[model samples]
Each structure stands twice: as C-alpha cells, then as structure tokens.
Target chain A: MTAALHALLWIAVTIGLYGAADWLYRKSGHRAFAHPVLLPVVVLIVIFEASNLDSAKYLASTQVFSTFLAAAVVGLAVPLYRSFDALKENRVAVMVAIMGGSVSGVISALIPAWLLHAPEGLIASLLTKSITTPIAVTVAQSVGGIPAVAAAVVIVTGLVAALIGPSVLRLVGVDDPVATGVALGTAGHAIGTAEAVRRSDVMGSVAAFAMIVNGLATAVLLPLIAAVVG
Target chain B: MIKTLAGIGFLVLLLYAVDGIKQALGLPVPSAIVAMLLLTFFFASQRRVPDFVDQGAKALMRVIPLLFIPPLVAILDVRAMVLSHPVVLFLAVTGSTLVGLVVTGLLYKALVRKRGRV
Candidate 1:
C-alpha cells in the first residue's frame, strides 16, 4: 500500500480508538485510569505490538495530528480572550504568579535531579517537565535530552498535577479562584488548565493565561538555567 | 460547521504564520507558543472576540486530548531509558511538579493578600 493510504487507515483507527476510549471514560464515571488520552494511547501500543506494525511508520503517517496540536495551542487564545476582563484587572498578580511559578518549577525539578544524580540527558528532560508539550519537547531537544522521553515525561507530569493539584491548592489555603487557576496552569499546563476551567470561567481564563505565560517563561528560563548549570 | 471550519482554518494559518516568522527571525520560543502569544495579543486588541472564532476554539478544545496521543505513543521507543531508573525519574518529575504547584499556590496567596485583591 502507498504510504499515504497506510497513513489514512491508521488515522481512522486512531480516531476510532480515541472515540471508544472517550466513551468508556464517560461510561466509567470519568475514572482517571480510563483517561481518554492515556487509555487510547495504551490501546494503540497494544494493537501495534500485536499486529507487528512498525511504530515509526505509524508515527510518520500521523504527523498531521501533531500539527493540529499546534492549532489547539492557538485555540487556547479563545479562553484568554473570554477572560480578558479578569486578566486585565489582575495583570500584576498574574505576572507575579507565573514568574514565581516558572522559576520555582525549574528549580524544583533541577534540584531533585541533582540530588538523585540523574544523568545529564534525564536532567535535561526533567528541566522541561512543567512546560507544555510542544515547547517542552523543543526545549528538551535543544538541551540534548531525548525528545520522546521528554514529551512522555511532560504528559505524565501534567496528568499527575491535574489529578492532585486542586486538593493541594486547598490544603495550602489557596481559596481564590485566580490563585487556584494560576497554580494549576503554572504546574500542569493545558491538562491542568482543563481541570481549572471546569471550576469556573474565571478560573479557566486565569489558568489559560498561566499556562501560556509559564510556557513562554520556561522557553526563556530553562535555556538560561541549563547554560548556568553547565 | 462552516463557521467552525473557517475558525479552525484561521487558527492553523496563524500558527504557521507565526512559525514562519520564528524561523525567519531565529527566535528562541517555539512556534506553537509564539502563535498562542500572537493570537492572544490579537484577540485582546480586538476588544470583542468574534462568535465564529469562539465557537471554533471551543470545538478544538474538545479534541485536545486526541492530539496528545501521538506524542504519548512515541514513548514506546524510549521506554527503556525511562524504565531503567523508574524510581528516581518518577520522583524527580512528579515530585517537582507537586512542589511547583504548592509553591506557586502559596506564593500567589501571599501576593494576593499583600496586593489586596488581584
């Protein structure tokens, strides 16, 4: 079969699998383990292994999906726009929250890597853990880390943060909606912001702002930190 | 449907345009991030977001999780390195993420109190 044809089939399969996973997640009362993203990915891996399909070929065909990921990032602007009033009013607090979060995110990740004696490559990947995937993968690549590993680590970090972030926020006395949004977005990126928006429109917009600012901050801060550490 | 498609098309164009500019300028930020920033700036400048654009963006949001699968599945290739030191790696990533959340939340609480309602 032509490569294009091969890709078409896989794309259809992927979407079908994802739809099924989404249905299952909803049916199962939205269990974490049945995560639409995670569960579909797991199923894909098993199917590929069973069929002996070349993983690289599948990836090559599905490159279009990655492009959509970029658009999705741009789509985030809608929420920001929707929450413009709150964002404008709290610009200073937002700036402080993101800067504080971004800097601490880098430090918190790096210190543990150093203490654990992780290899340079692993440390490099860990550096981008708090940022969103596209930027995180790019940052990882620039710093000599494995991009795939970095992307995986980024997703896992977001997932874990999204799962536990709200409770942690409450425990720490972060009762304000803006604070909750900023905290989740800064630490969890889009995945965390997904949960934040569920809380309220105000929370969602602030969270989106936090996620975007944090990404930009990490793009600049991480490289500087890497150079300094070296 | 057409409005949604048009909105999506507009976003994709903006994303690629920003990416092109980043490549031309040799900027440090990734194109996706730059696109988001540029879009946000543009939207904010407009004062009122278009109905079609808002609807389109909302549609895209529903599919965001699907877009992530490709990268997550790419993990199969690097499973060896990740699994080699699972304990330490997991600790570093998850532990730092939690720390970031707590520290940021706490700092935000203090700053909000000090600034008096932000």
Candidate 2:
C-alpha cells in the first residue's frame, strides 16, 4: 500500500509539473530559452522561493509525483529513429563538426579557466562540461573538479546555445538540415536535439549522432588534456 | 528475449573494456562515453543494430536534456549567483558560444569548399 501510494504520488507530481511546464512553453510562444525542458525547473524554483522550501523538502513532498517523467525520455526515440537517414547523407560534415566543436569546447573552457587562474576544482568540472551529465560528473570526479559545478556549467552552456542557436543559424545563412543538426548536437547535445526536432527531421538525427560522438570524444580527450596540464 | 539480454550484456562489457582502456592510459574516462563507444562498436561490428536496442537508444536520447535537471537544481546556492553575477555568466556563455560558432563555421566552410560537399 505504501509503495502504491508512493508510485501514485510520483505520477501526480511529474504530470502536474510537466503539464505546467508545457503551458509555460506555449505561453512563452515556444521560445528557445522558454522550452518545456527548462520551464518546469523555473516553476520549481519559483515555487521553492515563494514557499521558502528547501530542495530536500520539495523532493520529499513530490517523491510520489515525478514518476511519469521516466516515460518522457522514451518518446525521444521516435524522432531519433525516424531521422537516421539524414545522418547518413551528411556523415562527413557531422564528423567534422563533432571533431571541431568538441575540441573547441574543451579548449574554450579549459583555456579560460587557466588564464583566469580560476579554482582548480572548478577547472576539473569544466573539463567535462561539454559532455552530458553522467559522464560530466564522472569526468569531474576524476579531475578533482566539483561534479555539481560541472553540471551547472554544462546546463547553462547548453541553454544559452539552444536559446540563441536559431538566431545564430539565421545570421550565418545556413538553411541546411545537416549543418543545423550537427551544429546543435555539437553545441547543445540533448537540449539542442529537442529544438532540432522543431527545425527538421534531419537536424535531430544529426544531433543524436553528434551528441553521442562528442560525448565519447570528450571522455577520451579530457584525460589527455589533464595529462598535458599536469 | 535472449537478444535483448545479450545486447545489454554486450554493451556493459564493452563499457568495461573502455574503462579498462582509460585506466591503462591513466585517463579519467567518463562512464557514459564508455557505454557510447561500446554502442558504436556494436553498431560497427554488427553493421546492423537490432530494432529493440535502437528503440531503447532513441528513448534514452529523447529525455537526454532532463538528465541535467538534478545538477541544475542543485545550483540553488543563491550565494554563488551573487558572486558570479548573471551578466558575467551570460557574457561567458555568449562569448564561448560565438567563438564555437565562428571558428566551426569558417573551418567547415573551407574544408567543405575544398572537398566539395562531404
């Protein structure tokens, strides 16, 4: 009975939050920064602030309500599978983009940190900031950086890219799906993929391919960078 | 079916091998990358990923953005923001993004122009 109740609560909270996020997304006219992915987070923050609630308290209160979120990730597969073909056609550019972008992301983060003489712990986390969370944290731990800081930097970077990606694309005069997909995946990863779906099928496929490859590259290359710095 | 189990087993072992590679090289390899490489290798070796695994992979990628939620939320240390300042954060993000975009665009354009649509 307790388990059942817990499950029910998770479901309720997940749905309620997601639904509210969806409404916010629409309300924001589906803008890049106003995406549903970040909207729920914003709502949660506001609610927390207003109520003076701690994160632990919120998690406990909504433990039962967040279960439906598990299924949300499942739906991302549909677009990925559907857009595989474009990935094939633009394979060369996609590879080039990942190679270039991944290298640059590492350098940009590391070089700046070193130049600024920023905290070493922060530098470690920034090393994996370009990669996704699981890997980012792992890399962070390995390099003596705070995983939490790395995660935050990664999200902020991704959000900034996703928010401004379309404008940049337009300014560059790139209308190609392959370019769009590769660029987003290179910079934004998963968040970019979500926005890519709106642009075209080809973009999402490339984004997925890029995201995975970039993650792999960062994992391998970051250690090398660390070795050099040390 | 046995296929799904086998695929998963293959993926795990593959990741383990990647971890082994990192250790051997004295590198700190992220676990997700290890899994990804395993997946890529599987794709290459089989030259054909099974439909179910493909489905699972896609699903995983979909909510990929959400994986960062816990980390982002944890940044609720309001003190950090005051010290960093939103403008500084925005500048750092924006500047890096532009650098990424411009460098990539120029290099890619030159490479593609030379190669003619690869």
Candidate 3:
C-alpha cells in the first residue's frame, strides 16, 4: 500500500474503534472506566504489540486527530465565555481556590516523583498532570517531557480524581456546589468536570470555569517555571 | 451547517495567526491556549456568542475526546518506563489529585463562609 493509503486505512480503523468505544461508554451508563478514550487506546496498543507495528507510524497516521485536538482546545473558549458570569460573581474566591489547587497539585506530583527518582521525563510530565490533556501535552513538550506520557498521566489523574474527589471533598466539609465544582475541576480537569455536571448545573458551570482557568494558567506558567529552574 | 463550518474555518485561521505570533514573539505558551484566550476576549467584547461560533464550538466539542486517542495511544512507546514505577506513579497521581481536590474545596468553602460573616 502507498503511504497515504496506509495512513487513510489506519485513520478509518481508529475512527471505527472510537465509535465502538463510545457505544460501550454509553451502554455502560458513562462509567469512568468505560470512558471513550480508554478502550480504543487499549485496543490499539494491543494491536500494535501483537502485530509488531511501530507505534510512531500509528501516531503519524493519526496526525489529523491531533490537529482537531488543537481546534477543540480553542473550542474551550465557548464554554469559558459562557461561564464568565459565574466567574465574575465570585472572582476572588474562585481565583484563589484554583491557584491554590494548581500549585499544590504540581508540587504534590513533583515532590513524590523527585524523591522516588523517577526519570526526568516522567518528572516533567507530572508537572501538568492536573491540567487537561491538550494543554498538558503542549506544556510537556515545551518542558522536554514526552507528550504521550504526559497525556497518559493526565488521564490517570483525571480518572483517580473523578472517582474519589467528591467524597474527599465531603470528608473535608466542602459540600457547597461552588466549592465542589472548583475542587473537582481544578484537580481532575474534564473528567472531574463531567462528574460535577452530573451532580448539578451550578456545579457543572463552576467546574467548567475552574477547569479552563486551571488549564490556561498551567499552560502559561509551566514552561516559564521549567526555563527558570533549568 | 455552513455557518458552523465557517466558524471552524475562522478558528483555524485564528490558530494560524496565533502560531505565527507565538513564533515571532518567542512565547512559551501554546498557540491553542492563546487562541482560546483571544477568542474568549472576542466573544466578551461582542457581549454575545455569535451563532457561528456557538454552533462551531458545539460541533467541535462533540468529538473532542476522539482527538485525545492518538496521543494517549502513544503511551505504547513509554510503557516500560511507566510499568517500571507503577506503584510510585500511582501513589503520586492519586495522592496529588486528592490533595488538590480537598485543599481547593475546603479553602474555597472557608473563604466563602468568611465573606458571609463579613
């Protein structure tokens, strides 16, 4: 097969796989484990290993999806714009909570990995674990980390947080919608925000606000911090 | 459909412009983020989301998760590194995420209560 045809074939397969995964996710009532991104990724990885196909070739073949990822990141502006009123109402509280969460999130991830002597690339990737995947990938690449590792770390973080974040918040006496939303979004990004949305509209909007702000702040800050630390 | 497509085209154009600016100015921030901020500002200044932008953004959001797959699949390349320290990595990710969640929530709740008293 010509290179272009090979790429097109893989792209079709990926899209088909994603469709199946989405169906599963819906069928499972949107369980976190059944997330659309997880199954297809696992299946693809298994296929590559079984066939001894180069992962890099698969990544290259799906380059168009990455471009769409960038466009989706831009699309975030729409929700952010819609959430401006919520943000405006409690600007100080929201900003402070998000900043605190973001700082502690970065530090908590880094200190453990550093003490454990994880690889430098892994350590750098951990820096953006709390942010959404696209911005995390961007920051990871900028800071000399592997984009793939960073994306994986992000998904893991989001899943962990979404599963337990609300309970943890309740244990700590954070029952308010705004606080719950802010906490979930700050820690888990999109996955946590989805959970927050399922709880309440107020929670959903606040979570979306916090998630976007946290991502934007990390995207701007992580690279600068990396440069200075180096 | 036409408006949504046009809005997407406009967004792509904006992304290209931001990329150029990022390169010229040597900005460390991602162009997608810069585009997001600029688009947010544009909507704010207009005081309403244009139909095209709203439709376009919704269309894009529908399939955004699909975009994440290719990159996540790239994890195959570093499976060894990840597997080697699975316990430590798991602890760090879960611990940090929990700490972040609790701290942000409690602090926000405390601040809001404090404001209510005042």
- A1-230, model 2: which lDDT tens digit per residue? 48567646644654566667667777988776666667667766776667865766445545422221222222333444454666554456557867887777666766666666666776676666556565666767766877667667767777766778767876876556666666676777556666676566677766666766776677667777778877
Stretches off by above 4 angstroms in model 2 are: A1-11, A57-93, A110-117, B1-69, B77-88
Candidate 2 has what TM-score? 0.73
lDDT of 1 by residue, B1-118 (tens): 9999988888889888988888899976778777777777887787777877776777777787787788778888887988786876787567778888888888877877787764
Candidate 2 clashes: the total is: 9
**Model 2 chain B worst lDDT run, 10 consecutive residues:** B59-68
Which of the two, 1 or 2, has more lDDT?
1
TM-score of chain A of each: 0.87, 0.79, 0.79
Model 1 ranges with Cα > 4 A deviation: A171-175, B24-28, B115-118
lDDT per residue for candidate 3 within A68-183, as digits (tens), equals 76776676677677777766657798899999999998888888788888889888888889988768888899999888778888977887787678877888888888899999
Q: What lDDT score is found at residue A85 in candidate 2?
A: 60
Per-residue alpha-carbon lDDT of model 2 for B1-118, expressed as tens digits? 5554453344445545665787889875454344554455556666666776654444444444444454455567533742554443444456665556545544555566676774
lDDT of 2 at A73: 23
Candidate 2 residue A191 Cα shift, in angstroms, is: 2.0
